[model samples]
Target: MSNKNPSTTRIVELAKQKSFNTEKKVLDTIKSMIKNKKVINYNTVAKESTVSKSFLYKNTSIRKKIDMIRNEQADLKNVTNHKGNTSDKSKDVIIESLKFKIERLEKEKQELKDALAAKYNDFYNNL
Candidate 1:
């Protein structure tokens, strides 16, 4: 039981009018989804705008861009992890350097004390 509506077909035809190029329409659709804060499907856009789903997809497929974005995010995560590891390595190096400096200072102090005792004994015998 379909109602005979003449204006419905006309309305659908107007909706199918190409005011913008295929790529621009796809980009606009992406922006609209973001503005509405929801995900939209290409098939739905096709139903609304009367453009074929295959054609829309062929013109504005974001698979490559999405892949690149994912790769970039992974790289960022790796860099952050590397920086943390480097910081830990730097702290270890600093701790080792301070320990070496302390040991060297202690050895020098002991040498000076021994030299002073030897000099004092020789002077007392001579006097």
Candidate 2:
């Protein structure tokens, strides 16, 4: 009477049943397949588990975990780059400060020489 294909609908129902098991069996199977290099792609995982790709996409916790891992990797790269820049800047600042101090010390040395020469005429006369 209705538009239902009973056999086709029954297969679909069985596949859907495999998609939502409360036991750890489904996740464990997925992990084992990954470990054995059997399920290679998301499509394969979906097919093997009889789950839809849309189901994986809709799981907010799994999506958030993936995002967090990516964010942490990016943060690590940024910190490494920042450290390199800071190290270079610190070296430049140290070199500039040393150069300034050297110039100041040379100026003081010249001034002291001039003052001594002026204060002692006999020193110059004896020489």
Number of the top lDDT candidate: 1
Clashes of each: 0, 0
lDDT of 2 by residue, 5-117 (tens): 55588888887676545123435545676577462344665566666667655655434543454466567667766444468779899889999999999999999999988
lDDT of each: 0.64, 0.63
Displacement of residue 15 (Cα, Å) in model 2 is 3.3
Q: What stretches of model 1 exceed 4 Å from their correct place?
A: 1-86
The stretch of ten residues in a row with the least summed lDDT in candidate 2 is: 20-29
lDDT of 1 by residue, 1-127 (tens): 8768655877776656753465566566655754664434555556544567776656535434323544665676678664444587798988899999999999999999999999999999999
With a 3 Å backbone cut-off (N, CA, C), the pairs that clash in candidate 2 are: none
* CA error at residue 63 for candidate 2, angstroms: 0.9
